[model samples]
Target: MNIHVSYPSRLYSDKLSLDCGSTRICHDISVAIPDRGFTVIIGPNGCGKSTLLRGLSRLVRPSAGKVHLDGKVISDYSTREVAQRLGLLPQSAQAPEGIRVGELVSRGRFPYRRAFSTWSDEDERAVLAALQATSTLELIDREVDTLSGGQRQRVWIALALAQETPVLLLDEPTTFLDIAHQIELLNLLRNLKETGNRTLVAVLHDLNHACRYADHLIAMRDGRILFEGSPAEIITPSNIEALFGLRCVVISDPVSGTPLVVPR
Candidate 1:
């Protein structure tokens, strides 16, 4: 299979450690996200995958080490500055009561708008483009609380896309979706990579899906990276068994010709 290489992007972590209360999730892990590509993190439950993602997105402060964006420490930038550069669509995001789809998406422009400055045409275009891209334009007038799980996910993605950040991070974006919706979301994510200027990272539980959609696959276990490389190189049966403790056969996907993992 053919794979493309890209430069490292804004997000990177060195010796990163994260804690949940007194328990540490990960320790001394390092990562560099390639610029403008799709990178997926996969691992078993309770393996600190989500915690690692949280650290990268600045939702969880590192107990040790550091996360950097654009070769600078992330903490040096103000919250708004970080927001302008990195966008995160957290798992199971909730919308406010009575908030319309358009209203929820419009919030993405908050970092760009000053307290005294009114919303501009550019903001409107961004929101509209985001809605259209996610196929949520028809739902613009609908209340977010009334949408289905799949529909809500699309809307949330649109909200993130409206942020127009260079790096976007998602945590299990397919968690609650049915098979069709899961495929829909993955295809949408693949299309986002076509721009070749936006970086995408996601934590996924499905090894097959990760192999299919990821340009770079990170297999983590016990808060450490067991393997990191192109899916073609990283999705071996040995890596799959190590990551999930599952004996599996790795084959070429009939559709995409990417690595396909089938558990025995």
Candidate 2:
């Protein structure tokens, strides 16, 4: 069966700037996120990738400019309304001690519930589906602290999935995972993008993985976007060098025919 999904119009920033106290992190940044694609943001550490992600999610109010969601100012929407349309997974998410996996994931449904309404069948279905999709259904009753790093990461992702939003933003989702787990998580994200008409945005450190899995790439440097395009168009050695100030060898992945970067 074919399912038709309606996504909010692409989100974009106009002359966006971010400041924390007296420090300026991002400046005059403007870019449009595609309506339905996996877009990876890559850059050197402390280059404002995370800041930009926060701005996009409305977690950080921009110092200047505005973020538009579906042609409407994002700050104008009610918090619950925005939550129902967008979900953000930060790099470091801590579950309360002794929290059960199911209970942790169920929090994502909060936006769908009225203040005094009890959990309904639809909420239960969404929670179960998210757990199953992330392959964490079997761990539903387990304490989050007992899971491996990879498993815990999946649980967090499941929580975001349970939100059932059209726009999903992840900040450094593979931060603490080993190589195998990193690949696993990336593959899971790829599967999620393919299975639904959703837009996935992630801050990725591994350029090769970003190129391989992302349909679009946004390269940033020193708080500014250096380039934004398809992996094939933006993953050249010159671009990589400009973005990360590193010399690298760029080659094609044998399986996916995407660019692979070998740092020099």
Candidate 3:
């Protein structure tokens, strides 16, 4: 494996803490998600993996410290300004009743629109390109509520891509997906990163998938980050145990040649 030295980081945390109501879900987590890379955060349920991701996305306010975007504190930016630089795909998207795919995707252009402004040609082109990229162009006229799980997910990704941000974050994008859809989504994300369209950060539950696709990996447990590095450096048996509390043997995946964890 080549040492994947990161580009200058644009999104990072400085001793950030996240809260769910009055209960703290994450402790002080100072971490950097490398720019223009595919980074996967993995840990057991309730370990604050998604909480940390939400903080980075500014979907949740940091209870302590800060998240930085482009070397500036993210909170300093206006909501629309932040939306122009970053996009987020939550675990499950709730589309309006009977909303068509195209209409839902067009919402991504909200950051660029002025009050009562007409949708620009650039917005049209972006929405079209995003639909094509996700292979959902044919579904543009279809209602979002009428699509299958896989199809809906692709449409949701198209919506995010339409935003045209330099950074994108996903919270367990594969949740409730079958194996085939999960692979499809991961492959799409990898392609997004490889094409230099955006920096990718995802919270994932599957350790093997994280190892297979991540250029960098973060492991968390008990509301704190425990380890972070390239998968080859961080997916050792001991680290696996520390993060997931399972004894496992780590081996090279025959297909991708990334680390594969086999629990004993």
Best by lDDT: 2
- lDDT by residue (96-163, candidate 3, tens digit) is 99999999999989899999999899999999999988889999999999999999999999999999
The candidate with the higher lDDT, 1 or 3, is 3
Per-candidate TM-score against the hidden true structure? 0.95, 0.95, 0.95
What lDDT would each prediction earn against the true structure? 0.89, 0.91, 0.90
Tens-place lDDT per residue, model 2, 206-238, is 888898899988888888888888999978888
RMSD of each: 3.2, 4.9, 3.0
- Judge candidate 3 at residue 147 and give its lDDT: 97
* Candidate 2: segments with Cα more than 4 A from true spot: 1-9
lDDT of 1: 0.89
Model 1, which residues run further than 4 Å from truth?
1-8
What residue runs in model 3 are displaced by over 4 Å at the alpha carbon? 1-8
Give a tens-digit lDDT track for model 1, residues 8-35. 5578887889999999898778888877
